[model samples]
Target: MSDVTPKHAAALVALDWGTTALRAYLLGDDGAVLDSRASPAGIMKLPAGGFDQAFDETCGAWLASHPGLPVIAAGMVGSAQGWVEAPYVETPADASALVKGIVEVTAANGATVHIVPGVLQAGAMPNVMRGEETQIVGALAGDAALEHEPHGALIGLPGTHAKWAFVFEGRIERFYTFMTGETFGALRDHTILGRTMRATAQQDPDAFIRGVDTAKDAGHAGMLATIFSTRTLGLTGQLAPEQQSDYLSGLLIGHELRGLNEVLAREQSNLAGRTLRLIGNEALCERYRVALERFGCDDAKTVADATERGLFRIAAQAGLVRAAVRVN
Candidate 1:
C-alpha cells in the first residue's frame, strides 16, 4: 500500500466548491493538473452532516491511493454556510494573504482539507467575494506585467455579481461588485420584461450592440429609465421579441461597465488607454469586451483557466507541495 501510494501520489487535490457545483483536480507536485472530476455536491445541496460523505464519495478512490491527500478549496465552500466557515481577509492583500487565512478541517474521510478565505472591502460601501479572490491571485500570477504597473491594473470578472478590481504590486487594492447578471436574471424570469423576450441559445449581436450603445449614451444616471426601454422598444415595434433578451443583457452589462468607469474616474484612474484584463470564461468575457469597446475601452483581453492556475499557485505558496509524483 505504501509503495502504491508513492507511485501515483498526487501533490494535492484542488477543489472549486461553489454554490451549485463542486469541481476537483488532482495536481502533480509541480502544479500541473494530473486528473480531475466533479460532482453536484455543492455546499447548498448538502444536508446536515452530508459534506463528509459527499466528499468521500467524490474523491474516495484518490484519497485511498494517496493517504492524507492535502486538499485546498476555494469558493463558497468556505462561506459561513459551507462545510467550515473560513473568515474573510481584508483587501490590499495578495496571494500570500489568502494562503494565510486558510482554515483547516478534517473531512469525514480524514483527508486534511484547507479552505481559502474570501476577500472583503470595508467602509461606506462594503463588499465581499469568496471564490473570485483565488482567481484574482491566479490572474496576477499569470500576468506578471500587471503587478509592476505604476498605476495598477483594472480587472473585470463578469458573473452573477460582476467584480471590478484594482490590483497593484501583487495585491488587491480594492474591488467592487455589480449585481448586473443577477438583476438581468430576475428581470428576465420574474418581471414583465421577460414575457416580451424570447429565449434562444443564439444571442443577437446587433440587438446587444444597440443596447450597449444606448447604455453608454445614457450614462449611470439614466439606468432607471434605460431599463424601461426594453419594454418600450418592444411595445413601439422598434425591438423584436426574440432580440429583447440579448438587448437587455447588453444594457445591464453596459450599466456595469459604465458604473465601473465612474468608480475609476472617482479614483483618478484612466480606463481609456490601459489594457483591461478580464478573467472568466470566453462567452462572458466576450460580452464584457464588446461592452467595454463600445464604452471606449478597446484593450480588453480575456483570460481562461485562471482559476485552475490560481489554485496551484496558492497551494504552492502555502508550501503544500514540495515534490513531484506520478499520477495515473
Candidate 2:
C-alpha cells in the first residue's frame, strides 16, 4: 500500500536464500539476469523471527531499485525457519508440482510477497530438502548431454548435508541426503580430531581418496577403527599431526561413500542404462568421481554452479521467466 508500481508487471525476481546469505537476481522475461543484489541475512544467522526482518531489508533494497517487481524465492527461506513456512512437495514431482508459486507474504509496509516450496521425500523413512531441488532440476535442464539421453540420471549434490537424487523423464524420482559435511565438522572441530590436528589440514585429497577407498573396501563400521589408526599412526611416528586431519577426512568421506554405494546398488537394477552426474564443489565432485569410478561407473560427469543453473531452469520452465537466461 505504499503506492509504488513496477515499470513492468511481468518482471521476475529470483532469490536464493542460503544458510549464510540472501541473494536476489532480477531476470527479464527471457531469464537473463538484469540486476542482482545481496545481503548478510541468512536463515542460520537469524535463529528466530530474524528471517522476516532480514528478508524485508534485503528485498526492500531490491524493491527500492526496481519500484515494484514480483519476487519468487527458494532454499531455506521456505523452511519452518524462514519468513513464511512453505510446505514441501514430495519427490518424483514435476516442474508444475515442484514449482510452488509465490505465496503472498506481507512485508513490513504491507506489500505482498511470495515464496517457493522445497522438495520432500517420503516412505518408510521421511527426508526433506530445501533450495537444492531447484538446482538439481536446473542442472538437468542446463546439461544438454543429459536431455539427449533417454535414461535416468544420478546427480550428487555435495554440501553440509549432501544430496544424491535420480532424475528421470523430467521428474525427480527419488533422492537421499547424507550428513557428510556436518558430520565432518562435528568430528573435526567438536571432537578429539580438532584437538589433535591443525585447522588447515582437513582437505588433503590424498587423504580423502584413501578414505573413500577404505570405505569402499571395509564399509561404515570400519570408520572407528580407521579413525583410531590415525592417532596410533601419529603416536608411532608413522603419521604426522598435520596428516591427522587427512586421516579424519578419509574416515568421514569413506563412510559417506559406503552409504552412497548402497543407494546406487539398490537403484542400479532400475537404472540399467542411465548415466551419473556429479554436481557440487569442484574438488568434492572429484572425490565422488574417484569413489564412483572404483565401483565401475565410468561415465560420471561433473559441473559447477549446478544449483544456480538448476533454479534458473526451473524458473524458465514455470514461465516465471523465459529460457534465454545464460546460467554461467
Candidate 3:
C-alpha cells in the first residue's frame, strides 16, 4: 500500500454516530468544520451488525466526493450493539487510552470502516457510556471555566439519560447517570399522570417554581404522593390540564434537582463560594437555573451544543484531528 497522499493528509472526518442519527463532520487540520452530512442511520434503527451497512451507505457518497480522508467515529457506533464493540476504558484514562482507529469492518458491499469505544466504570454495579463521553470531552475543551477549574467542576447534561460528570485535574474523575427523561416519559405516558396532563402545554414558570420549592423542602420521599396530587387536584377542579403537565414536569425536574443538590451539598459544602455550570438546551437549562436559584445557588449559565463541541475537543486531543479548531 502506498502512503496517504496530500489530498487525504489535508482533511479529516469525525463521525458522531449517535443512537438516533449518523452525523459526518468534515474538519480541517485546524479543527474548523468545512462541511457536514447527516443521515438517519442511527444505531437504534439498525439490526445486529447493521452498522457495517448503515455507515457505508451513509458515508460512501460523501467519501466518493472526497476520497482517502481518515474517519474517526464515536458514540453508539462503538457499543456492543454497534458494528464493532470498542470496549470501555475506565475513568482517568486520557484521550489516547480511549482512542481507537478504524476497525476495518467489511460492509455488505465489501467496503471497509472503523468505530470508536465507550468508557466503562468498574464497581459492584458497573456503569458504562458509549458516545456521550466524547461530547463531554468536547464541552470541556470549549469552556474556559471548566478548563481552568478542571478539578472541581460539575457538569449537568440534560436529555433522555442525563449525565453528571465530575472532572478532576482535566480527567474525568467520577460521574453519575440518571434516567430522568425515561422516567418522565413513563410517568407521563404510561401512568395516571397521562390522563390528567396534556403533553403540549407550555410549562408554567409559577408551577415550576412551586415544584422546586416543594422538592427542596420535601425531598424524593414525597415524590409519589406529590405525583398523585396532580390527579387529585384535577378531580377537585383545582388544576387545569396545562397546569397538570406543569406539575408533572416540576415533579420530575424537581426530583432530579434534589438528587443533584444532595451531590453538590456533599461535594461542595461551601456552595456560596463556587459556581455551578449547567449545559444543555437553552430552554431546559433556564428551567434548571430557576430551580437551582430556588435552592440558594444563584450562579448558573446555559450553553447549546456543549456536548458536540466537547466530543470534538476529545477527538482533537486524541490526535484524531488538529487541536483548538472551531467547527461552524
Which candidate tops TM-score? 1
- Candidate order by lDDT, highest to lowest? 1, 2, 3
Cα lDDT tens digits for candidate 3, 1-328: 2345332333466788878989887665645566777889888988876776666766676566656555677878777777777778887654555564324455564444445567677898666777666666666665677666534666777778877777765666667787877887888889877897766536688877766676667765867767787788789987777777776777777777778767777855533334657666678778877777776767666655554465455555565454212221
lDDT of 1 by residue, 125-210 (tens): 99999988888887877576575566787788999998988888788889999998899999889988998987788889999999
The residue-by-residue lDDT of candidate 2 on 12-119, one tens digit each, is 667888778888776655454666778878888885767667766766666665555556678888788778887888877766776654455776755455566787
lDDT of each: 0.84, 0.68, 0.67
Count of clashes, each model: 0, 3, 10
> Candidate 1: where are CA atoms >4 Å away?
1-9, 323-328
Give the lDDT of residue 232 in candidate 1.
Answer: 97
Give the Cα error of residue 250 in candidate 2, in Å. 2.7
TM-score preference between candidates 1 and 3, better one: 1
TM-score of each: 0.93, 0.82, 0.83
List CA RMSD, all candidates: 3.8, 6.0, 5.4
